[model samples]
Target: MSPTRSHDGLDIGVSFEFFPPKTEKMEETLWASIKRLAPLSPRFVSVTYGAGGSTRERTHNTVARMLRETPLKPAAHLTCVDASREEVDDVISDYWMIGVRHIVALRGDPANGVGQRYQPHPEGYASTPELIEGIRKIGDFEVSVSAYPEKHPESPDVVADIELLKRKVDAGATRAITQFFFDNDVFERYVERVRKAGIDIPIVPGLVPVVNFSQTAQFARRAGASVPAWIVKRFEGLEDDVETRKLVAAAVAAEQAFDLVDRGFRDFHFYTMNRADLVFAICHLLGLRAKPEEVAKATAAA
Candidate 1:
């Protein structure tokens, strides 16, 4: 049997990723997405920080609100980019004070943009490994780091990518979340390589429901993830058909999640892009259910 096949009765746990909104409209959309997905009993939810700490205040405030208002455990993304060690440390301390125990540590991209030279701040943590170490020193955070299934664009090869992950694990990353990929084989092969390296961290596959194929295509190019030619063909000429596109998006994502679950991956991290209906439908198809507490709350609200 393929390793991907589901084993005995293990419950699948899901988590979601949302970016901090920059406008009131976006804020409304973000909260709508959160509330829509909240009833599914995700293991946690995360708010992403922008490149070079651009969303620092918003990220902190959003995460703080989640702690105060929601049952979801909020993981805040922290990066060592364009900031001093002291500045980064202050941010970490702020998160800790707000009762956050999880962080996604990253060596952020250049503020100028991708393909530009990356220069670490002389006083800040350099790479993700260094960031992980710094986080561990400050608090017992359940630190998760990024993994590139197709290998980081800056990496010379897959071997180098695996080695980098090992270094982060050694430095105290509790888990690894991969960049989104359409091909499950990429994830499967990456996991195989990760296990062979003797690093036993849970590598959760990140799922992006392709609501807008063109936007996702552009993003995949920027992030160095490949969008298979066949996938484009699947959504070909549907640009003007928003409803049909959404239906297709849900079906594709649902199939991918079901296949992963069958393969024994019980954890998934969805990149929601602040859209709720599609991701919510996909999670429902994955057998996720609201706990009684959440259902009661939803019922009361209704």
Candidate 2:
């Protein structure tokens, strides 16, 4: 059977991605977001570690707490960065012990951060495919890796990017989740290329709701995603009005999401950025309803 699903867009599935909190207040906010979104019954939620294994301990504590207290399945993000094979293996084993059965395996940005030349540790897995191989050897993890709709910044071209993805597939990646894109046609084209390469794993679209337009544009620039001029025009001059910006953000996100559904996409992964209201509103616009029992479990987990 396919590890995730054959996303012909017939059956809907949504997943959320969250980062480990850096402060107690942030932690409270994260759990509250989880509680709010839980009733939508996401396929799974994922917790991310920072570049170079930073936030490692907090990530573990959060995922472990989820397993103990929530009905949601948490996918821990693991990276090949600044850590030896043994160290990475130990972390994977710990996740297994805590019942984390899924992982978002990645070749993380260089320790210095993005835009620098990526350097693999002398004793670390060299790339994402090797990371996936290592993860699978340690346990039967439902692994997901990143895909770039706009070719990765360092990749010479889209062909090379897709080639690397095929390697991840051969190395046992269960599915591919993309970076957020403002243009749906871009995602569709990327998927077509991936399919032509003979990779059938579900390529789930990642959506990021715009909380602040200028900030989102900056992030997109760094991540190799383009913010279309139309999007810029929509958020134009709302800089001072936070409330109005939010309304615009919701309308833009909703339009993007509903358009994808019309284009026949069932599986989605949201980069929640630790805020729930905008994403929740968009999902509700997509016609998803909350589940009562799941909501109770989320409250208890919180």
Candidate 3:
């Protein structure tokens, strides 16, 4: 189904994802994007944790700052990587102490990087299900877990992937955010399978605007998400033209979002990559507008 030009009265909920910045300039950029998108009143903004707990401290600081300084609710990402059970539990306790109510729990990537074999820390929670259970024991957190519509790279098959997600839900995951995919049909089929497996929690579609086609394609490969041939053709020969690329990216994401809305999907999670232009534009296209009160509040916070 093609996206229609009009979305006159659709009601859609949105959330955004950001990674902890590694540099001073990136930090400024992250907050700028936050201030720019805060007026839209996303359901919640999430900060990503790096593999092997590499960004644990940065993620904590970012999430804590967001909670203390902004009106936006932040969901912190927690991963079972190099940390032991005691350390992971301590981090969970810290989040609870700081008034954080939501966490995205996962068994993160191997310490080396993606595409490598995942070796769990002998002393840490081995899998996401274990991590979810640990979080529940530590606090009453509304937990979110990763869902791979395309099947996780390490999974033996799609069924196994669904089974893993079920384990997470059984352990107390309240929601699931999918890995980003270019084809909406892939997501639809995955959701159907998830339902058939008796996993009924909200499976929020993760939408990524292709701000840089090449970079996104690389990420898609690593994350086990497919970059459709049609999408590749759309960005063909535009490598040297950044302005056109941004326009194309916005159009592509808006179309995908509108198509999903037409398919009766209402909630969306955008992997913002710490940039607001594309996501903000796509949200605008989805019939979302900045409330006056929210705008004033965001401006004051800025």
Scored by lDDT, the top model is 3
lDDT of 3 at 158: 99
- Itemize residue pairs with steric clashes in candidate 1: 4-262, 4-263, 5-262, 5-263, 6-262
| Number of backbone-clashing residue pairs for each candidate, in the order shown | 5, 0, 0
Model 3 lDDT per residue over 247-273, tens place = 999999999988998888988999999
lDDT by residue (tens digit), candidate 2, 195-294: 9999999999999999988899999999999999999999999999999999999899889888888887888899999999999998877777777777
TM-score of each: 0.94, 0.95, 0.96
What is each predicted model's overall lDDT from 0 to 1?
Answer: 0.87, 0.89, 0.90
lDDT for each residue of candidate 1 in 199-230, tens digit (9 for 90 to 100): 99999999999988999999999888999888
**True-structure RMSD for candidate 1:** 3.6
Q: Clashing residue pairs, candidate 2?
A: none
| TM-score rank order | 3, 2, 1
Report the CA-based lDDT of candidate 2 relative to the real structure. Answer: 0.89
Superposed Cα deviation of residue 173, candidate 1 (Å): 0.5
Backbone steric clashes in candidate 3, count? 0
- As a TM-score, model 3 comes out at 0.96
